[model samples]
Target: MPAMTEPKLISGNSNRPLAQQIARRMSLHRGMSVSLVDARVERFNDQEVFVEVYENVRGEDMFIVQSTSNPANDNLMELLIIADALKRSSASRITAVIPYFGYARQDRRTKARTPISAKLVANMITQAGIDRVLTLDLHATQIQGFFDMPVDNLYAAPVFALDVQHHFKGRLQDVTVVSPDVGGVARARELAKRIGCALAIVDKRREKPGEVAEMTVIGEVTGKTCIIVDDICDTAGTLCKAASVLMDAGATEVHSYITHGVLSAPAVERITKSVMKSLVITDSIQPTEAVKAAPNIRVVPTAPMFAQAILNTWSGTSVSSLFDVDTLTPIYEGLYHRG
Candidate 1:
């Protein structure tokens, strides 16, 4: 196996703090040698997008850190331009490290006329000259197959599991893991198995994008402390509604654990008024000011995990075991259920 060279970290305008955190984990600051030129990215009078990258990236193993979160178009364009710049400047390799990959929910088309936006995004990235991709908790695991190049889908479950263990040490006997919807059963099941707790599912009906009606619980949540788990919490509609349902089902307390916090449009207020005790989210997407100010929202940093993955990848070691569920099962089981 070839030893990986020191990677050059570059940041677009998407999430500077996260890029800084990842750099800190790697024990290196952002490279000062390459200049990141901020070009005015706006549509013409007719409303068309344009981009430019003013930096040189010749012969560098460049990594562009950008999260396609809110204001997805602008951030996506910035990433594409930066990758193009690196490719044109003859960079040895360009890796796109996207903590939050937007449009991931569209991995497959539900309706006949709808497009597979996730595949489209993959095409765009590949065409933009990105040699590889590293993203966290993609909505659909199969989205990775959409890409032609190597894709590393890192898990935030270990981070969440560790935090859960730390917070509820001896009181895990009454805990129950929950999936906010049927689509997320796999994720919640993994967490439940790790924590050694019984699992529950929330069956919901979506009226529209930001509207949800939680119907019922699939498993035993009655009298149990419920932790609703999901990949992304955008409007907080599904989470809040599911929590309400759980509480009405005699759940002692309702909490939420989500991977990406894309808390958009009135989500803060919704969570504030909801019955949830707290909503724990990873720092995949940079939290908005509203999210930062929300009292019920708490953030868990993924710096250590990302750092470990980067080191392992660079060292030609297997990163698959970083958070093996089987290895951590005993720890989580003891913390959550076994006492």
Candidate 2:
């Protein structure tokens, strides 16, 4: 087979630190050189987004690193405009590397007269001329079908498992993975299986988005190190409540491993004052100053995993193995080398 075109990384304003980290890891690849594209994504006086590519990317494979997080509309627009700009510049292929896809929680309608914003966002990306998508842990896995192009949805379980192993080095048998709600049992089960620990669920009566009326521990958590696993932690009302409930149920310690820390509003304060031992989150969303200053919060790097996935997609290698628990150790150990 002929050699594929060199891949170029580009970044929007959403999460430049993470983009730089991914680019740095890619550039460290043994026999290949990958670099970020020199591009300017600016705004007009009326707050309209504008993009200008300085490099001559006539036939390059482009990957735009943008997380549609806090300013969801602005970051999303920047991605779409960047994709359109790259398409107009004659790039061979464009892949959107969205670490945190916004509107994902709205994958379906829960009430009367509401739009499925997740599907709408997917359609917008398809219409914006992106050829493919590379994202991590969609709120609803079914959202992948909303796009017309190929979508690579990566999981963070392997990364979390490694952290869990390191955090509770001697007490693996005393750990229990707890899902904040029944809906997240599968996620918690996968993590527990990876760590060879027991599984538990918190049956919560959710009153609203961030509010939980009551919670009951469904399994034995007494004297165990409880680790709450969930995707998005917005206002954190539910997480805080769940942690207290677990502790009340005789859990020795409570820690959380949430993927996207959408720590909005009083989330930081709530988590800081809660009984949870610590909250470990990924850098899927750029951590705010408050999130950084919080005493009990820790952010993990996803750049190594993301860089590998990007390289695999460009080289047409299997990406599913990246999430395999056994393969992740080597994948993280040798990220700068070709697989």
Candidate 3:
């Protein structure tokens, strides 16, 4: 495969610091040489969105860094407009590097007349002329199938694994990896394998939106340090409930490692009052004010991983090996010891 020329890194209003960190790792500046047209997004009297890009991007390989998180619709619109601008300016190719894809949990219709909002979001991006996408930890892996163009679903396990190691030192045997629900067992199993620990699952049922009732435990969590792992934590209901159940099951301590801390309504409050020792999350979705102020919340930087992935893709190298399980073991051990 022939290496493509280096792509210009563009940024939307979401997580600018993360985008800058990735750019620094790649030894480039954001929007280098090319004119970055800032889209001054506004609302009409009735509250509809309007966008216009102010600069040129002709003949460049474009990578727009945006996270469809929090103010979801606004951020999504920003990404669409940026892509449209690049397409209109004759950019050679456009890639939407959405570290956090919102509305992913709506991938399936649970009722008779519900819409698959995840698919709708995919359609919107596709229609906006994005040639490819790079995102991490979709709520459901099948969501990738919804996209017609090339889509890279990066894993946050490696990132979380490193943090766990650093915080636990060499006592991997005492640690138990946990899945907050049955659907997350595979994810938890993978983390347990990488970290060389036993695995457990929390049997939980969502009584209703934003409410979770923990029913049982699938594996042994007794007298062991438990780390609840999940792709996203929106309301914190499920996570807190699972943590409580693990404690009742005789787990020594409870901690959580979530990919995207959507940390919406009462989430921080719930986490603050839960049995969790700490809530470790990635910088995929910028945390809200409450999340930032929470003492038990710690953020693990993902810039290096994303930077390397972007560079590898641009240089026409295989990224499959980047997901090596062994490489992450030591990193997690180190993080465990530090904590």
Candidate 4:
């Protein structure tokens, strides 16, 4: 068997800091040092995407780290162009490490003449010569079916669980995991189960996209520390509203652990002004200046987890073990299951 070539990472402009952090974490995992590919991903005069890989990637495994975040189209285009460049350079394998998958919320058609944008985006990635995908906490788990190639959808539960354990410590029994709406009950239940806490759901009636008609708490949260678990925080309208409803339901305070902080306009402002004690999110989407300046919002680094996932993928190891609480290390320990 031929010796496996070291994997080369190529990052688009979407989240260079995260890409660099992942690269550094990977280097620490093993004796062999993994480095980023010398690539220049820039725009032309008319705002068109361009890519150039300076190093020889012939037969080398390549991974592109790019999040389809704020400028979704531009970043997504950069990823495709980079993949095409790598394919032309004879790269043996190309995997897309998309931390935040945009258009994921549009996985299904809600009305007539509506497009399933998530499926369309999956097709675009597959057609770009990419062989596999590694993404964190997709908005809709079913979106994995849209991809023709191998797709690894990792959960942020381990990271969030660890943080919860650390923050809640001796008061773990007083913490209650909450789902902002019915659609997220499963996600909330999993976290609550992992943390050995009571589970609750916010029965929210949304009349429109950004409006909540009514909300009612489904479980006992009186005097409990409520923690809402969600995948993305876009406008934060749902989160802020949920927090208010939870507080009104007699919860002492509310916190949130979201996988992606796609904090669009007024999200930070809403979170800052809301009664929620804190809003914790992963560094899946690059944080803007306002998010950084917000007092109630905190970001957890996904680099360590993503780095381990990438290493496991490269070694043909079981990536799912990373989520097994029993197998996790001290820094990322498993959540306790109280009877």
> What are the lDDT scores of the predictions, listed in order?
0.80, 0.91, 0.82, 0.90
Models sorted by TM-score, best on top: 2, 4, 3, 1
Candidate 4 regions exceeding 4 Å error are: 1-3, 330-339
State each candidate's clash count: 0, 0, 21, 0
The pairs that clash in candidate 1 are none
- The digit string of per-residue lDDT tens for model 1 on 15-59 reads 888877777656632223322233344456864555554555567
Pick the lDDT winner.
2
Residues 1-339, candidate 4, lDDT per residue (tens digit)? 333977779999999999999998788776667778887999999999989889999998889999999899999999999999999999999999999999999999999999999999999999999999999999999999999889999998877887887788899999999999999999998899888999999998988898889999999999999999999998999999999999999999999999999999989999999999999999999989899999999998888788888878887888888786554544242333322
lDDT of 2 by residue, 1-339 (tens): 534677789999999999999988887763566667888999999999999999988888899999999899999999999999999999999999999999999999999999999999999999999999999989999999998889999998889998888778888999999999999999999999998999999999977765677889999999999999999999998999999999999999999999999998999999999999899999999999999999999998899889989988888888898888666676567422222
Candidate 4 CA-lDDT value: 0.90
Instruction: Give the lDDT of residue 48 in candidate 2.
Output: 99
What would the per-residue lDDT of candidate 3 be over residues 146-257, giving only the tens digit for each residue? 9999888889987777777777877778999999888999999998988899988788776787766547998988889999999998888888888888999999999999
Model 1's TM-score against the true structure: 0.88
Q: Where does candidate 4 have its weakest 10-residue lDDT segment?
A: 330-339
Q: TM-score for each prediction?
A: 0.88, 0.96, 0.90, 0.96
Clash pairs (backbone) in predicted model 4:
none
What lDDT does model 3 reach? 0.82
